[model samples]
Target: MCVVLAALLAFELFQPAHAQIPNAAQGYQRELTRVVQQEWGMNGRVAVHAAQIHQESAWRSNVNSPVGAQGLSQFMPSTSAWIAEIYPDLGRAAPYSPGWAMRAQARYNKWHWQQLASAADECQRWAFALSAYNGGLGWVNRDRRLATAAGDNPRVWFGSVEKYTHRAGWALRENRHYVRHILLTLTPRYERAGWQGGAPCNA
Candidate 1:
């Protein structure tokens, strides 16, 4: 019992200070916390979602991408419409509603992850998943095949698939940056939350 208590105390001592959710993002952070922790059981990786919120629109509910992605998670109008058709409550929520947009993001990520089930671990899994979230899954998969044909592990992301994406013409930098940024944002927060080995190269 004494050893257990000490272990727990050590864990608490090393945890990072709470994430500094921005003032304008008060409600957005709250809803994101709820979705990542409660609905998705991703409490250890809330920062990945937080990273997307930051990258996509800097937590702005009203922001719109030049490509037509709107809201905190930057869903395209057609994608938003499709999400709404599949999830009535989530889709019905205003595009500017942080909760709704993030909920959609979580929903999309859940489905997106299914397509990469062969990923070696959390690192590889999220790397490919985030890339797919930015670029199309079809393209990410095509690159994965290219990497494998060139003797890389299709299941490993960093040195394998991500390396090949640099030579990919369409959105090459964007796709690589998407995965890198998410890992950067995710690792710090998750480590603070007691998660282990979430780096881009971990798997």
Candidate 2:
């Protein structure tokens, strides 16, 4: 009984840390995680940003947002071209190539997060990076400034932003659904990997 309890406790502790992120996520999410892990040396919960990508593009390689963001991770054409230019390894083909796009996203995500302290954990940086990825860091910054001016909580994710406050459009709805999907998908994987966060496989 003691041995069984110890085994259960060990599994519980190691579960989230060893949680297997999908190697391929039907389309964009898979390609994106490959890049993130390959280029960024990020895996496990540290690479949770893949969840954000899954939510955003649902693995579409050639999708363009109504706002004109393009490709798997939905980069703005200018952003895509600019990244390609800087990392010429990410050439014209890079934007269209899922593999290249993943590396590019990893590079971009790394660069963006490097602006913050290295001591920060993945959860701390991932959420901020997701905000930047989704809403544009400039937009997020502008919102923060406005919130600061208004004496609101400028640092947290409370619904202080005008769009969030107003429940703007399908972005919020779609994002929520996507995040939920990632969470649900992860729960099962976590269980299979011996995580206590999920129902028993035998049951």
Candidate 3:
């Protein structure tokens, strides 16, 4: 009995803390699925998007960050306005609306994905896109250019362009952590929880 109890304790201790789906995220699965499919088609990386949302707002529809980011997708006011303007179908900037936030997040991620054609692979492309989402596409572009100038592979993200940022140390750390946390950590977590899309990094 002692040995059996010890084995059970070990199993529980070894389990990932985030292995379970977040309670806040449970309510939005259907809406997220619909939005992701609409924006990215059937094979869209829903898990990746879900993980992004997890990082952004932990599925809190009413969250407002100290820096003025808002809602589930955590879009800053300026970004929300811009996205609404560019995609008029999204209507007014309603960052606090769960539906709007999910759709806007998908659209914004798609926009980043479209511009990163030089990425070495799907995984690298997503890393660039996520970095763009966290910081700015201009930063990623400059970093890639700098990496190229230094003989690093501009198409790669992890050890290449990610190492060439011109942003301050804090911003650089946040961006890199944001990309890796979403793609490498949270993506797999969402995928394992039975989310429809698979992890891009695992591809």
Candidate with the greatest lDDT versus the true structure: 3
Better of 1 and 2 by TM-score: 1
Pairs that collide, model 2: 25-30, 28-59
Candidate 2 to native Cα RMSD, angstroms = 8.9
Using TM-score as the measure, the top candidate is 3
Cα error, residue 178 of model 2, in Å, equals 7.6
lDDT per residue (tens digit) for residues 1-203 in model 2? 12432454445454564354443454344444455566656533322445445555655667778888776667887887777777787667355566766677777776666653331343334444555566556755665577667776555432343333223567555543433333334434434543232321111
Output the better candidate (1/3) by TM-score: 3
TM-score of each: 0.78, 0.58, 0.91
Better of 2 and 3 by lDDT: 3
Cα lDDT of model 3 overall? 0.87
CA deviation > 4 Å runs, candidate 3: 1-20
lDDT (Cα, 0-100) at 166 in candidate 3 = 75
Residue by residue across 1-203, what tens digits does model 1's lDDT show? 12432453345445454564454654555566778665567543566777677778877889888888889889887778887998886647466787788888888887788889999876688888888888878888988998998998899887678877545465898888777756654345544553332333322
- lDDT tens per residue, model 3, 66-109: 99999999999999999999999999999999999999999999
Per TM-score, what order, best first?
3, 1, 2
